[model samples]
Target: MKNYFKFKVLPYLLYLLINFLYFTNKKVFHHPKLKDDEAFIFVAWHGDLVSQPLNYFNKRPNGTVKTMISQSKDGEIITKVYSLFGIGAIRGSSSKGATKALISTIKEIKSGSDVAISPDGPRGPRHSFAGGVISIAQKSGAKIVILSSKPTKYWQFNSWDRFVLPKPFGRVDFYMSEPLDVTNLEFEEARDFVRNKMLLNIVS
Candidate 1:
């Protein structure tokens, strides 16, 4: 059944797949030391979700980070995959259950959980930054960090964002921007700031 596959079969298979890819890949971080006490809202591109679960957990073993994924079928599958890595996803998006999602995310951040979201996510214009991602940081008092990466060897899908999957034993170079305070930024200003950061790091 479709439900069975989404809830059981898919998660198991994807878990194995990601684990193999992640465990085999060499990750190099380019950012400064990140403190555990500070909650941060990290923004990344959706395509990079391929190794995100392990990326976050491996960086901070407590698995304190969570993400906002859509309610679409792909989102369902990804949510399960995230669970397998001890990561969590808060389902829903700007077009659906936007309010509830915003509230829940704020609570998580306030509770000292680092949260990540793809500003260009769910469905995308691919790497476009939207203003909605800023409000959570403003309201929760969490600073924003732009999460980006470059892999020495990888496969790029022909999907909208050209999703990436790092080949086994490849090297991944990751870049995390300094925590940015968006508390007083206008919506447009915040969006531009995020967009510019992506341009600088080029999350591919």
Candidate 2:
């Protein structure tokens, strides 16, 4: 019963919830353009995943957006939800089969597909940066863009990452930082630069 609901019922509910929130809420976009054929990596905090996919796909419906999700139960639900939304999901995590996932993501990016990742997710210290994104950007020669969304009114779950749930009819403010070129920077430097930029955009 639990698995049925989680893998089936819950995804549809979330699909409806996201569609409602997306259509009803006032959405703000910043730095919305990316070359149609250029591949880029979007890095966002886990808390904003609820709305980020809708925001990205709605604007770039023709572009392919693939996200890295964990191999856990929650990831399964999220993968199903994303599929319903016409997005792609690669199941893995920083702690589990991340290398294979990263390799696959790099190939996708190299093929001119956009990829999204939550640097601090699947059990996070919250808002921290991981080097995996940097590796992907470097290897794939894709620019990294920091994305975030803030709602005027919302619920904050008391989970490890303090997950966010935007209220119906609320306004959501989306922020996108200037794209950073990670291909030239050393691994640590690229990671730090992205972390700071994401923190600043998301918080400010």
Candidate 3:
């Protein structure tokens, strides 16, 4: 029964839940004007994921968004949920098989697809930005933008990231940071800059 639910039930429920929330929520985008073909790497806290995919993609019609998902059982369910929304995934956690995932994601960006990374994800010391994203932006020559949000109502999961699921018809401020060219900043400096940008835009 557990296997049946894992393989047959979870993905459908998650897809229905995400779609329902996406349609019900009132979202406000405070983001820079984006170019359809411009490759970008988005930074998001692992917790703020529930409505992000639909909202972000709705604003950009031409590019695809890919993420690095782990190889675990849970990752499989999440990947299926993502595919339902037409989003793609590079299999592997940011920390475990990071080298391969990082390389793959950089290639996707250079090919004009947008990618999103939760700096503290797949397992976490939640909300703390990590260096992998800065490295990807540097190598891929893509702009890095943090996806910060404030939601009027939501449920927080007991998981490490305290993953947030925005409630139905809730108002969400989907404020994305202005694009930063971290390709040239010193490694640590770049990391700090992105982290600070994330901090400034997120509110309680």
Which structure among the candidates has the greatest TM-score? 2
lDDT for every model? 0.80, 0.84, 0.81
Error of 2 at 190 (Å): 1.0
Candidate 1: Cα lDDT at 59: 64
What ordering of candidates by TM-score runs from best to worst? 2, 3, 1
| Per-residue accuracy of model 3 over 1-204 as CA lDDT, tens digit each | 998899678888989977887678887888788767688998788778766776577577655899888888888888888888888999877668888998999999988889988888878898777688988999989998777777788888888888778888889888877789988799999988888787765543
The TM-score that candidate 2 achieves is 0.95
Q: What's the C-alpha lDDT at position 63 in model 3?
A: 58
Q: Tens digits of per-residue lDDT for model 1 on 1-204?
A: 989987779889978987787678788877756787898898888778775665565567774888898888878888888877777788878767788999999999978888889888877888877666888988887888877777888889999887888888988877778888888888788778877877675545
Q: 2 or 3, which is superior by TM-score?
A: 2
Residue 169, model 2: lDDT of: 89
- Cα lDDT tens digits, model 2, 76-99, are 999999998788998888989899
Regions of candidate 3 where Cα sits further than 4 Å from its true position: none
Candidate 2 or 1, higher lDDT? 2
Candidate 2 lDDT score at position 40: 82
